[model samples]
Target: GESVGLHLPTLSVQEGDNSIINCAYSNSASDYFIWYKQESGKGPQFIIDIRSNMDKRQGQRVTVLLNKTVKHLSLQIAATQPGDSAVYFCAETQGRAAGNKLTFGGGTRVLVKP
Candidate 1:
């Protein structure tokens, strides 16, 4: 399938270091937010998510922070590694959970140097 939007911006960091990827969304009505990671030539995979009711959420090695006030969101990766290198982006949805579709941000590419 064709890509829906433009390529992500890039962020480079060293291995074993912490990586912080940020995003600014435009929808204040969007109640649900998600962060995704996409490797080269592949589809996006989910990392973490937070609803409008929450400010922060965490996964195994990743953390997602949402600031509804400024319509900003961020992803923090602990101990960056080669495998963690990929394009990261934020997606948001509103209205009915079943009917809501995700709207993705431009994206940011994270390069982890060994």
Candidate 2:
């Protein structure tokens, strides 16, 4: 299937350690990438995004990196906290237009240990 998927289904990290989640996509036309965090019973919240032309983007405590050559994406969370435990998803779209369809990866659950 030509869809997005995570390399790992789950990741465990110490409360104060940094965590990295990886996603792979088969679509070469995708120009926009977004990382979302979904807490239990809650909707996915946008963490960060990067354009295909850009190699990396950073948020307050998060970083999103895009590798067009390998069609890989990664999200890094600094100082992983218990509150950061959630299912993370990477989504991609061909364009930023209103009708551009967003394709999401299966998602990876991050478990933060105290």
Candidate 3:
């Protein structure tokens, strides 16, 4: 089984500032990683993703970075806003095959301050 965990339990970002969230995974075999944002009472929403072959990936004001050597993953949010406040999680999947389950991290709460 794979284990994922965030470096911090919470992150505070000033409005309009950038926020970086870090995560580490135990399984070196995991090839795919995803970053998800979960608002209060809502399910996780996909933010960005990166494959083991890629070092970095960007999507709409967000970036995902993968470091397979250290089994580390990170998500960056640009110009953090109040709406960006949520619990962020990093998930890893070992295979590309269908039905592969994602191993999610404990999650880090991002607080946006005005």
Candidate 2 per-residue lDDT over residues 18-109, each given as its tens digit: 99999998799999999999877778898999999899998898999999999999999999999998889999999778867889998998
By TM-score, how accurate is candidate 3? Answer: 0.90
The local distance difference test score of each candidate is 0.87, 0.89, 0.88
Report the C-alpha lDDT of model 3 over 2-110, residue by residue, as the tens digit.
Answer: 2222354889899999999999998888999999988776778988878899999999999988888888999989999999988899999988888699999889989
State how far residue 97 of model 3 sits from its true place (Å).
2.3
Please estimate how well model 1 matches the true structure, expressed as its whole-model Cα lDDT: 0.87
Decide which is better by lDDT, 2 or 3. 2
Inter-residue clash pairs, candidate 3: none
Model 2 weakest lDDT span, ten residues long: 1-10
Can you rank all candidates by lDDT, best first?
2, 3, 1
Least accurate stretch of 10 residues (summed lDDT) in model 3?
1-10
RMSD of 2: 5.0
* Model 1, span 19-112: residue lDDT tens: 9999899988999998988877789998898999999998998899998899999999999999997788799999655857899988888889
Q: Flag regions of model 1 displaced more than 4 Å.
A: 1-7
> How high is each candidate's TM-score?
0.90, 0.90, 0.90
- What's the lDDT of the predicted structure labeled candidate 2? 0.89
